[model samples]
Target: MSDKASLAVLLCNLGTPEEPTPAGVRQFLKPFLSDPRVVEVPRPIWMLILHAFILPFRPKPVAEGYKGIWKEYGGSPLRKITQSQVEKLQQQMSENSVLVDYAFTYGTPGLVEQITHYRDKAERVLILPLYPQYSCSTTAAIYDQIGKYNLGQRDVADVYVIKDYYRQSLYRKALAESVDAFWQKHGRGDHLLMSYHGVPQAYADKGDPYYQQCLDTSTNLAADLALAEGEHTVSFQSRLGKAPWLQPYTDVTVRELAAKGVKTLDVICPSFSVDCLETLEEITEENGEYFTEAGGKTLRLIPCLNDSASHIDMMAAIIAPFVDVQATGQK
Candidate 1:
């Protein structure tokens, strides 16, 4: 599609490094951990741990985890999958004279670079976060970065933000369809697990609303799937620091379920639009091993909605109210 001079659309997702190597991961981690929205500790203290300890020692293991999920295609599944989503959105939403592209808030193809690219073309811009549920650590941080860059640019396009869609009906339907499709293929498991990334408990206590929204998402999905209370469950994963975060840790929960004689499990990560380290490494490779070793017979991972038609539709709906388009999709 040709770049137009009046409108630009940018899709933003948490990024990954170029590859699954230590150097690649280290590069990715630097900006990610440096974000104040993410770390939240005093800069002096966090920097010390980040440089002296975490950066020095953590890269190898994290790299190894990335290696487990690395595709033969070279780049990270996170970036590749997210790029697929962006391309589809661009194709579907081509009618508004908008040039659609995506950028990472961290790592290469960064936000500033994407904005500069778009600024050269479009007079108006929309920043859409891929996260369905907003956390200060995720969505708000993207807003902050964009705000900082737009500080003194008179030539910059007018910008609009698409907020969270945790309660959107189309989103819930798409999620339910994914689970049902997996069940049809893989056979019904003893339970369906909805695992989301964890945030610090303090964030919720301070009114972040991320945790509550996660619960509501789980409840809505379960009802749509006609799941009994004990037949479905929700948990959290990906706690980065020592701070107390959301409860029912995913790994521990999987182990405990196996211990209770529940075998044959299927897990879906609704929090992630595209599978990444947390979903691929933590849930599929790591927790799958953990669950099986803990006595569960089998564990299957239902893939994320990356580039899926339903997912694209839901994302288009989220931004429809902001744009002047009569209908989305190509003419």
Candidate 2:
């Protein structure tokens, strides 16, 4: 693989609607929800539920939620931020014998297309799924796609996939710095809420490490920020269906904290690499209302790291080991 002249790095993330409309939402949701890694239910029954019950009604309301955060640039916040991340990473590595690009796990610029684009130009490809904490539903689904793509090819590039980086020192430092910077500008709140996106409890019971990784990330960040025992809490958000999910659910916890006289809360979603409907609509808008309605003065959302200079530097560091700079004659 080192014999090839160039290297291609592919950054991937969960997708968003192409546009903030029902049809767009449906297009994104269909491929996303249909994945067994995501849904996990028996397919025959799940398909009926998805087609008859879900698709008919879910798209419009979801589209409306997306519209609340759609950018003037004509896409969801996740798409815009991810594109910026790719562009910055490319510029950051411009002098190296490497090319950087990004794609979605389920939407436009699909994984297969991006992988194919690099097949001829580069001898080696590194895939980095942008989930800090790995879960079967998210990270494993990416592997499934790559596996499917590899099945059709006689010749494939040398591929390296980063499974997770939840515990990397640089990543944790970047997260802590982002939070500290937020506090420096806005001041600290009564308590910090580190809310991660939830998965069904059964997934953890079956040995998914996502729950533990989220806890580890929160623990590391809290220690970095020097928070006392009572100063921070961990919860899970964006649960679906009747099945039990990792709990101390965010909405319930927010209401309870406000009722208990905890005022001026600080909330951050550690699970999201970029702000999307979950953070923008669900956390900032919906759950913010829940807190204030329950007597809290404010629920301040600390932004994701996104494409900040620190974040790009951290990304470059994480991918450095997989890149053969000596082989490519990079710096």
Candidate 3:
């Protein structure tokens, strides 16, 4: 391997617990909820609340939710989906002689492993958050981890951060294609609800653009699909605590639609690149039941972007513009 070899691309994501147990959820949620960026509460006070109240009480229920999404792969859906993504990305980049790898902000395949792998080998490194949109809690947390890893490197390689590609054309096209494919397989529903993970209103008010970006993605996707006013809806989900979050809430909207005589729904989470508890448990199992119970005849979940062929193409397109030179007959 030459020291002057082309770029090494690493895609990152928010991770999942190692298992579907209380201890597992505790392990994952502790760091995730502890982050000031994610929670934004005072350390002493928040720690007391987290350790004393949240961790002790919330773990069992959260673990149960994890159980709902646990796959036969011996890990949560997040891990499986992300692993598939890394593999597909590697296949795609191999064609261009661009090395592709991935890691999680939390859990195994950690930043340490990813950094060591690339920094020790590659000449130039590109860190791309697997997120489509930027959020202080999500994307910024990944940035912090990257910074921490960089500080510990013996030989700091040329590192470039590919911030957010929420509006990238290829990305939008992939998403539209995924949704269309899903609809084709399952048949189009009366309404297409685009749901995204919700952050607190305080974060958005304080300048987090996550909410706006979600709206932008939803609008663009709707336009691309040529969905009419009543054809699709957008809502936020997975809210925590009493703090106000982006609304209208997905559950509330689903029930409302049911009451209004909407019989079928196709739900998709554009914000999530992988299938996890949020998508599998909350949206599919719980919310699907909720919608059906509320008089909806059917509630079909269009799966996340994941590592589908179209998604891999989108990933390649996103990295193509950033690579210095295209490789020839590489893979």
Best by lDDT: 2
Candidate 3 accuracy as lDDT: 0.83
Q: What is the lDDT of residue 116 in candidate 2?
A: 84
lDDT of 2 at 123: 71
| Global lDDT scores for all candidate models | 0.84, 0.89, 0.83
- Each model's number of backbone clashes? 0, 0, 0
What TM-scores do the predictions have?
Answer: 0.94, 0.97, 0.93
Candidate 2, residues 60-173, lDDT tens digits: the string is: 999999887884436678888998999999899876778888888999899888888886677788888999999999999989988988888787546778999989888898
Candidate 3: 10-residue stretch with minimal lDDT = 322-331
- What is the per-residue lDDT of model 3 for residues 69-181, given as tens digits with 9 covering 90 to 100? 67444666776777788788887666565778777887777866787777656667878888899999888987787677768767665778777888998889989999989
lDDT (tens digit, per residue) of candidate 1 on 1-331:
4345456778889888787889988988988998899988899999999999988888889999888778543668887888888889878877666577888899778987888778777766788888889899999988898788888677554777777888899999999999888889878999888999999888888899899889999999989999899997799998877888898889899999999988998899988988888887788888999999999988888989888999999878876666644323333
Displacement of residue 306 (Cα, Å) in model 1 is 0.6
